[model samples]
Target: MVTGLTLLHTSPAHVPVFDALRDREHPGAVLRHLVYPELLERARAHGPESVAEDLRGLLGDAGGPVLVTCSTLGAVAEALAPALGAPVLRVDRPMAAEAVRTGPRIAVLATVESTLAPTAELLAEEADGRPVSVRTRLVEGAWELFVAGGTARHLAAVAEAVDAVTDADVIVLAQASMAGAAPLARTRVPVLSSPGPGLAAALRLCGADTTAAPPA
Candidate 1:
């Protein structure tokens, strides 16, 4: 029995993206959620090592590949890489590279403040002093909409936020929670969702080519 693992922050905004990917691969695979409001509250309260331990515990003895998704949890995945002993996908890196390649002006929208640092660092490194212009903004109340069962509202807010960043050539939605908002995030620029890249990476890690058509 092959199993695939993926982690989501306590937010349900990621449901659509995860559900879509899961239906494509393992229809009934288990999904683990790690909630740490305290850890997420403070900017420097914890690091990846602490988050990784929580992940290992939540994913106890699950024998399969794991794909972790979180804008603020990338460092956590990095810390857990040694322990999980399986392929871990950090959703932002690929998106960052894609953003850099798209053009000079890149706009990143995220709900959490923690995501800003790593995202900026990743983009800077990927840009490699190409004089790329990077701008970031926090979607002030979008996450609350997700928690309050207002997914559509959240998507609308995200679209509005993206629209506000019209100067960008490409927009990167940093949080997986923001994935559902991708389709609604109408922009003259390209909107890159974490799930697309994350799912692609997960398929590659599992050695599965998801490029095939879905069942009729």
Candidate 2:
């Protein structure tokens, strides 16, 4: 039985979101976090393998379920999963699965440039040989705003970007932090976020029931 979770995240700002969900889903289940912005930065600066070695070490040490919370590093998580010797879940995998079901015209929106490629790749992989048209958009200056703690401003920028992508059948928010900002978009099509489904999946992967009542 799974009794703990080890969350791997690129940004510290995302911890609260996952923490709340973990607490709600399974209160007091051992939760450990590995936050390293430099990991993703290294991926961008050098290559995905740049962080694979470090991730392997982390996963080897994680005694419970591990969740990769960064879209940019999700590929590395998948690659190292075979050697992880434990259950590993990607935060965006569920989102990718659902997004591909919507339509072929998928638009992935992100604030960080690094998130785009991996997200689109995940969607394509989820499509499972089906022809899917995936385009990516980076919200101008949204990452800066988010890093500066201007979350509202950052969300507004993301919402605007969503509004601008009218041709897309569905919009996939590439980063977990942007999950909350999706609803702010005035769009006719579905706007998808990873955090909700991802957290649900994580709980399940770790042998916790989504409907299981939390401790009062």
Assess each prediction's global lDDT (C-alpha) against the native. 0.70, 0.85
Off by over 4 Å in 1: 1-5, 24-50, 56-62, 128-130, 214-216
Against the true structure, candidate 1 reaches a TM-score of: 0.79
- Report the error of model 2 at residue 58, Å: 1.0
- TM-scores of the candidates are 0.79, 0.92
TM-score for predicted model 2 compared with the true structure: 0.92
- Deviating ranges (above 4 Å) for candidate 2: 24-30, 212-216
**Collision count of model 2:** 0
- Best-fitting candidate, measured by lDDT? 2
Question: Which pairs, if any, clash in model 1?
Answer: none
* 85-123: candidate 2 lDDT, tens digit per residue: 788889999999998899999999998888888898899
Q: Per-prediction count of colliding residue pairs?
A: 0, 0
